[model samples]
Target: MKKILHAGNNLKGKQANPTYISFLGPKLEAVGFTLYYTSQKQNKVLRLIDMLLSVYKYRAKVDLVLIDTYSTSNFYYAFLVAELCNLLKTPYITILHGGNLPKRLDKSTWKSKRLFKHSKLNIAPSKYIMHEFKKRAYSNIKFIPNALNIEKYEVTERGCERLKLLWVRSLTPIYNPDMALEVVRLLQNEGLDVSLTMVGPDPHNKFEELKETINNKKLRIEYKGKLKQEEWYKLSENHNIFINTSNFDNMPITLIEAMALGLPLVSTNVGGIPYLIEDGKEGLLCNKDDALTMVNCIKKIHKNPDLRQSLIVNARSKAESFSWQNVKALWISALA
Candidate 1:
């Protein structure tokens, strides 16, 4: 049996760690491949040493290595992973998950261009990301949409009294949690009995700032810090509107989960949002950083029953195309 090393840092006992790293393990193992994953901290000083140690440890066993892309185009890890793979004479693939990499590259003073130049293969989750990399004429790139299995959400109304808006992302700067806070404030200011549940753990770095934003704005937000994926999905079913405040995102699983739950979507038009949404169709996209526009989009769905019903129908249908069974075939083809 062929052995593969899953080279990515992990957060101790965190879902995102196992969840993201376990992607290729099952599928590859089904085909008689042995997958070994070792999680390491992302600290630069120690990270390089840990990676070299991993390469040395796995050198004699694994046939191939798949490196997880560091979040938001941190160029540092990408370079290290690629260069390490080269030094060890091992073949590797880098899955680029940062949807806002294009913006960072455009604004970056760092040497992303130079570091990524030696990358073997770049696996992008959406065309939006691929488009950004392709614009720079990067080769050896493939578009692999986020693999999602269709979820079963029992359609039922949780109470029609107050409009429930759900935000299921980390309270991080990249996600622009303040936009969510501001939108909720706008809803309450308009005398709307809207309730918001912000689900997801603090990325540690931005939790304090996020709390300050909520306290400063005096918004009506319930910080339900980090929910299990299943719980969050179940919660999404009870919610009416799903909002994504990410200023930089490719295809977010949150939006897909919302669609599967038959909840209408109102997201900012940034990163690869356009790839997942057909404005006024499956979902609505607002100009990035425009809390008023985001609020207006949600209010539009809240007020018009027919519009909400149509969008729910359309969004659910669009989401079907991204099911794990369906998307895996695309990934297989890309690997071919």
Candidate 2:
């Protein structure tokens, strides 16, 4: 069997683990590619060193390498690893995951140049990043969305009366977990029968403060820390609406999974979210950190049965486009 060396920060402890390497690596292995991983270390500098060593160690063992390139500080990891891969003469491909990566081009032009130029190809899971790279004359890029096994999701009918809101992502400041709490508080103040369930690991230890705010405000919220893929989908059956309050986002698999399970989304129009969700179409979009607008959106969806069902139908249709059955061929062609 051929081999693949995947280099990325595998969010090992996070509950809503949407790491692309974890999702795609096994799929590649099932099709006869032996997958190897590096750098589950939380520290950034150590992770970069680990990734470099991984490339050197697997230099002759792997068929190709896959790097998860981000637009944030982690972008340096991709650059350093790509430089090592170039010296080793190993062909590598990068999967772009940063929503704010367009700025990376202007800020770190030289590094971005070296990273993409050395790679055999760059796979962008969202058109948001793909368009930005293309405009900058980066031609070694391919648009392939983050995908999931559709068979795993179970769809259920949702009552538009009670707002059973669900938020799934790591409890990090960037994701703005606090924003979800504030939205729930605002809605409850208006006497809306709303409840929020947040499912994800708190890597930053922010749970105590978050819990205090919830208790202080007396909000109807439940924190289910870190659920398995199957467990979350099963939990979705008891919920209706899915909320994504990320300050920055890429093609989030949880958002796609929610749509597949027929959950209408009310998310901030930041990063790649707009690219994935069309306002008043597949899902509702609001401004970042605007609790009032989110409250209004939830009220709109709750009152209008027609609008709610329309979003469900359209979102599910759009989600079907990202199923593994549809994306498997793209991976096969890329690897071949």
Candidate 3:
């Protein structure tokens, strides 16, 4: 089997919720690749240290170093590791996962070029990132959709009565968790009986603030602090509509999972979301930061049976295309 070194924030025991590496590592292993990960450490400095040491240790043993490249400070982790891989004359590939990556490149062109220009290839999980890269004249790009085992997600008859809404994402400002509550508030103010459940980990202490906001408003919103994939899916049974209130985003796995489970999607048309979901087709897309519009879309889906059924059918079809069974060949070919 070919050995692959995956350098990312592999916070297995430490994280409140699992990262994408947790999902991808196993799939790669099942397809005949031995995977190694770095930085399960809680400290950022230690994580960087672990990543550098991992590359050095696996330099001769591994076929390629797979770096989980981000647009934030995590970009430096990729930069340092990629620089080391270049010095060792080892080929490495970057899996681009940042929604704000283009801005990172534009802000620091020199560093971005040094990293992208040196890597063997850059894997974009969405066409949005691919289009952004192409605009910057960055070649060596590969389009690979993020994969999930479809069997794990169960589809149910999803005609919602009380407007049971669900929002799942990290409790961060960028994701705009507050807007989810606002949407729920608007629905209730209009005398619609709606309930919301927010499921995610709190890395930036945003959950406590959100909890306070929920209490102050005295809304029927439940804050589920960080659930495992199975736990969230089970909770999703009570919900029919999935709300994504992100001010910015990429191809969110939560949205895809919601689509797979036959939940009608109401998301902001930002970043890679438009690429994943078509407005009024696969799912409903509202303008970013438009809570009133989001509320209207939910009402439209609730009252219109034909529109609701059409969205579910098309969304499931879209979700099926992203299953691991369909995507495994792409990874096998890329690794080969």
Candidate 4:
């Protein structure tokens, strides 16, 4: 069995949602690969130190180091870790993430090149990221869609008697949680009976602003801060629609989970979302921050039963292609 050191935010119980490492580590282990993970430390500085130390400690023991590369300040963590791997003559792979990463490549060209070009492989979860890297002439990149256990997600029939909108993501500025509230407000203003439930942690304290807006506007919005996967899956049974209002995103696992649960999707067509859901096919997409368009998309789904059924069937089909059974071979081949 190959020994792999996976480095990323393994913050499953740390008041944050499970990231890629948290999900992928166990899957790899179950498939006969020995996996080690690093840096569940919440503090940024301490986390960086821990990640660096883990790389140094496991440098000789592990066959490969899997770095979860992102576009934010955490990008620096990936850069430093990859450089450490390079200096220690250890093979490493970068699992690319975040929709803003293409911008990061342009903004930090030299750093991006050093970090990605020297890696053993660059794994892109979406074609958007793959295309962006290929555009810059990077040949070490490969497309591997993110995986989930499709059997765990139970699909339920959606009754269109009332609109129950579900939004699942961190309450961050980039995700634009406020847009969800606005979409709900617009639907209600147009004399539609709609209620929204937002599930996510407020890492940046944006929930305070959202709470104020919900109170002031008197919208029927329920803010359930940071639920476990199963908890939210149960909550999803009450919801008929899943809305993603992120201003920027990669291929979000939540959207795929929503598809598996048979919730018709209405998302902003930003970043890699278009690559995930074709407009009017698997789901409906609108411009970023355009609450009105999202409202219209919801209205379209609610009014048209055939369209809703088509979206649910098509989306669930697309999501099944991302199951772990199908995707594990890609990982096994890439790792080999």
Write candidate 3's Cα lDDT for 1-336 as tens digits: 789999998886523557689899999988778998887988899999999998999899999999999888999999999999999998999999988898999998999999998988999999999999999999899999999999888888865778999999888887999899899888888999999988888888887787787888878998778888888898888888999999877788888999999999999999999999999999998888999999999999999989999998899899999999999888888888
Worst 10 residues of 1 by lDDT: 10-19
Predicted candidate 1 versus true structure: per-residue lDDT over 1-336, tens digit per residue: 667777766545443423456555677566566787755665555765676678778988877677777445345666676677778787777777777677666765355664455655778888888888889877778887776667554444544457898988877677888788889888888999887888886756565676786778776677777787778877776678889999788787778878877888899988788988989998888998999999899888888888888888998887788777777665555544
Give the Cα lDDT of each candidate: 0.75, 0.89, 0.90, 0.93
Models ranked on lDDT: 4, 3, 2, 1
Clashes of each: 2, 1, 0, 0
lDDT of 3: 0.90
Judging by TM-score against the true structure, name the best candidate: 4
Answer with 1 or 2, whichever has the higher TM-score.
2
Question: Which residue pairs collide, candidate 3?
Answer: none
Least lDDT summed over 10 consecutive residues: which range in candidate 4?
9-18
> lDDT per residue, candidate 2, 1-336, as tens digits?
668899998757654355788889888888887899987887778888889999999999998999999888889999988999998899999999988888888999999899997789999999988888999999988888998888877679867678899999888887999999999999999998999999988777788889999999999999988898889888998888899899988798889999999999999999889999999999999999998899899999999989999999999999999998899889877876
**Residue 161, candidate 3: how far off, in angstroms?**
1.5
Best by lDDT: 4
* Best of the two (2, 4) by TM-score: 4
Candidate 1: list runs displaced more than 4 Å: 14-19, 40-48, 71-74, 103-117, 151-161, 205-218
TM-score of every candidate relative to the true structure: 0.88, 0.95, 0.97, 0.98
